[model samples]
Target: MHLPIDLVMKIYYMILAVIGVPVNLVAIVILSRGKCGLSTCTTRYLVAMAAADLLVIITEVILRWINLYYFPVSFLDITPVCSVIAVLKRAATDCSVWFTVTFTFDRFVSICWQKLKTKYCTGRTAAVVLATSCILLSSKNIPHYFVFEPWVIIDNVPWGCATIPAYVTEPGWVGFDWFGTVLTPLLPFAAILLLNTLTVRHILVASRVRKRLRGESKGENGSDPEMESRRKSVILLFTISGSFILLWLVYVVHFLYYSIAGINPDYYKDSISTFAQVGSILQNLSSCTNTFIYGVTQSKFREQLKSAVKYPVSSIIQLIKKKQNN
Candidate 1:
């Protein structure tokens, strides 16, 4: 059944999200605990983005499970639930994308214009950037809330809810769908790609310059530690976000195909539909990969995680010793 597989996926997603939620919370806590005045710009931005992703994981994915298995939409008061669900889902998904874009731009600035490091990359400016992104995404999502309604299904195994027929004629439904599915993803993805490419190139040249300055001719082109690390971050982000773009691109292409050409290839309908949902869920799951990426790439995050992990171990040992002493 559709739901049986979905249920399996939900279970897997829950396990991963459970880990992501608390880790993100800790990252937020660490970031908050810092002396983050206006000067600590990129640091604050990354941690804030982490916190937002955490909230999204909890509210969107967790609640998704509750609705999917526990209470099908038909059994509940559909209006408020769907509205809340819609908002949470949109906010979380949009937050992931926008925040990633923010983080990428921040990196681009630090690398491209070193002056920006001192000038524009302040905590206050970062906050403004984040606030502006949220406002924009929310404004874009307003259409979804206005247009969607409780979809009643007859003779389906269990009543399900979906955004009501967006296919029908109206002034701007098609445009809205394309905007969400393609325009938003494409525009930002494009910006991120451009910035990331430039950043990597700069990092490479900078590394070569630094190595030559030090007269250390004992390494390969990308083997410099800092340069290699930044290169990996660029690659990781590209791979992660590239997967997301391709997945959404399929949906966008399919939607456009039907709209313009009235062609519904059965192959696309079955496979692509499942791929879009399952892949989106998995891609969302991959958001947690950033935290791990931080652990691997950023020494500070790794050290902190190590200490956090060891602290419990030490505490448990001390407890056993105290009991022995007693």
Candidate 2:
């Protein structure tokens, strides 16, 4: 029997929270150790991305979704508290998307602009970039706090957060909403595509030139270590960015439709509502994908993941052996 969409979504989010939390934590732990055969700058970026994804899972999936579905009434539902959570959720989401953009750009520069890569792709620079992005993005979401009002007043205390009715029509709030939308997935989508396109173009040209220089154009087919290294980097870069683009595509389309049609999602018809919900599901699903992408594209990451998976069993076996000896 087919289940209700609402029920399906509830189950989907519960499973997502269960998987997303530990997956990102594992990725953060593994990448931060700097033993994944990634450069310091790349490691820093991956760690930051994982941390941002983890926060997204906590705020968006667990706190917002699970709390809404399961708890229904808790301290987190208080107007002020939920407003802060709203800001954090938006900031974390923005960081997650923009971090991917930043990493894509870093890889693009490293592959296409060798001279600039030495200066821009250093660990210090990566840290600076990530910190600045975090600060600015977090600050960008501060205005969201003021957009909410008490859902209900209970004996002088605000019970829950609801967007002020004026949020849709008021000039300032409308402008802010538009600005935030444009700043995030919209700009990020364009940026990643543009950067990836340029990187691919550059690599094709460079490969041809390098091949001729290595005498492969004439007859001799020899190994080119530089190209091989670049091939791996390109694979990782494309997989991560491509995953982001595909997963976010539905959300982008929905956003355009609703914004252009000037229709609030709350008033959507059943089919349209399901479409919107699916878009949301896909969007949150993006948070869980980068870890799998790393595992697939980076051999060292897979190795580390294997070791992490075995550590508990290994420890248990050692404990059993020691007990027998004792």
Candidate 3:
């Protein structure tokens, strides 16, 4: 039987939530353990990112699934609960996205401005930055809790979360879109682009310098494993940032176009909505790939993950077998 597109999207979100939650959880566990003894700044930012992604999956994606399937029976239809969930979703998504930028900036400093790393890129500083970011973003999202209300339809109690009717027509909404799409996303996009470009240039020049030094010194440290680690981290960040750009760029462009060009959003509802949905799904899918990227790029993460999972995974399998036999 064929399902409606709406149902298909709900199921897609369900699939994403199921896959993303555990993958990000594993990343949080691995990053928190400091198994690789990498810079604590990197560890803290990565752990924060992983935790934010997990929360988005739980509070946004899975809760959305319940709302779509359960309708009036879902807590999502309640005004307070819906508002809180919406705020949580926005906060978590902002944290997850912006924390990636924070991580990228940290790497940029460690590599490009090696002098500043000693003073600025400490674990304590990272903790402060992360805490400040959370508090700031959460505070910014507080208005959303007040703005979103439950809207009823077809004699149903309430369908979903939406801005109160008055707010939708206000000029503030255009500013909101501009801030959400442009200031929030494009600023970091530009920063990451500029920083990563300079970083790659520095890595290449540094690699050449290293080669010359090795030639002159003959028996010095072989290839500087520290440089190698930094190189691998650069490659990993490139992969992740590239994915974020690809996933979000279309939506950003569309939002900016509509906002700046003074096009009515409802005008393209029929035309661009599918594209928007695809972008949204891709963004959600992005949250699931980071752990796999870590696994591919870092053997230390794999080792810690195996150590973390092996016992409980096997015991659960054995229990399942016992239950099957009984």
**TM-score for all models, in order of appearance:** 0.77, 0.97, 0.85
Clash count for each candidate, listed in order shown: 0, 0, 0
| TM accuracy, model 1 | 0.77
Task: State which candidate, 2 or 3, has the greater lDDT.
Answer: 2
**All candidates: CA RMSD in angstroms?**
5.1, 1.2, 4.1
Instruction: Please identify model 3 stretches exceeding 4 Å from their true place.
Output: 1-4, 70-73, 153-159, 164-169, 216-222, 260-268, 313-326
Clashing pairs in model 3, backbone N/Cα/C closer than 3 A: none
lDDT of 1 by residue, 1-326 (tens): 35666667667776766787887877776556563221277667767678767866776666665455555554433655666667767766787778778877876786678877777777888888888988888677766666555455456432334555543444377666657756456676688778878887887788778888766766534346766556655654565455556545654555565557533333246655675566556555645666665665556666777777899899999999999999
lDDT of 3 at 216: 39
> What tens-digit string does per-residue lDDT give for candidate 3 at 1-326?
98766777877887787789889988987798898657798899888988988988887678765466655366566767888888888888888888888888888888888899898799999999999999998888887777765666546555566666545457886567567655557887898798889889999898878877778346555657867788788878898788878877876776666565565544456557766666677777777888988888888888888888897998999999999999
Residues 8-90 of candidate 2: C-alpha lDDT, one tens digit per residue: 98899999999999999999999999998899999999999999999999998999988988899999999999999999999
Off by over 4 Å in 2: none
Ordered list by lDDT, greatest first: 2, 3, 1
Q: Give, for candidate 2, the lowest lDDT window spanning 10 residues.
A: 258-267
